[model samples]
Target: MKKLLIIAVMALSFGTYAQVDPTFEKEGDKVKATYFHANGEIAQQGYFLNEKLEGEWKMFNENGDKIAMGNYENGIKTGKWLFWEGDVQKEVNFDNNRIASVNNAKTKSPVVIN
Candidate 1:
């Protein structure tokens, strides 16, 4: 019975530590967002301007690996972005939220693998 009680307590503690829900905090007009993984790691974090995605945003996989990073303006994708898939890195350019160009580089750059 003592062993059972210890195990139950451990399980509950670990369970609470494993999963953390995402949180959004208001910062003036922008909303700061933070998303968490099942392992309680940060998955993505960024800010929303005027209720739209704005500024730089970073995305990570469940393993807490950065997979993609880019910027937004008024909820529209703009500028250059980088994405990672295994050993390859992809650079994408956006124009008015549309794909303007894409460049794939075979380099050993650590990136989030989604």
Candidate 2:
């Protein structure tokens, strides 16, 4: 029992410091990057131009589920971003890091015929 407790403590301690390093690949003048979660799952992925976030980026939750996806230009958020919240999916459009619009889609209930 003592040995089991020690192993559990070690595992928890390691999890506390778990980190995922980003991998970069050169593409012309920009570099593409993929960041992983502590569980070795992809957390976020996008491109960098001049060392700034650019192009399309995707973010996932720790469970490897897509949480948000959008585009960036020179570290500025642009285009539409989709986010998952409970049973609803929210779409946010950004322009130059500013929110331009928002749309939400929720589950619809079906009607029963008499």
What lDDT score belongs to each candidate, Candidate 1 first?
Answer: 0.91, 0.88
Clashes of each: 2, 0
Model 1: per-residue lDDT, tens digit, 1-114?
Answer: 999999999999998777688899998889999999877778999999988998999999988788999999999999999998866899999999999999998889547877
Best by TM-score: 2
Q: Once model 2 is optimally superposed onto the true structure by TM-score, how far is the C-alpha of residue 9 displaced, in angstroms? A: 5.0
In order, what is each prediction's RMSD in angstroms? 6.9, 4.2
Q: Which ten residues in a row have the lowest lDDT in candidate 2?
A: 105-114
Residues 29-55, candidate 2: write the lDDT tens digits.
Answer: 999899998888899988999989988
Give lDDT: candidate 2, residue 85. Answer: 64
State the weakest 10-residue window (summed lDDT) of model 1. 105-114
TM-score of each: 0.73, 0.76
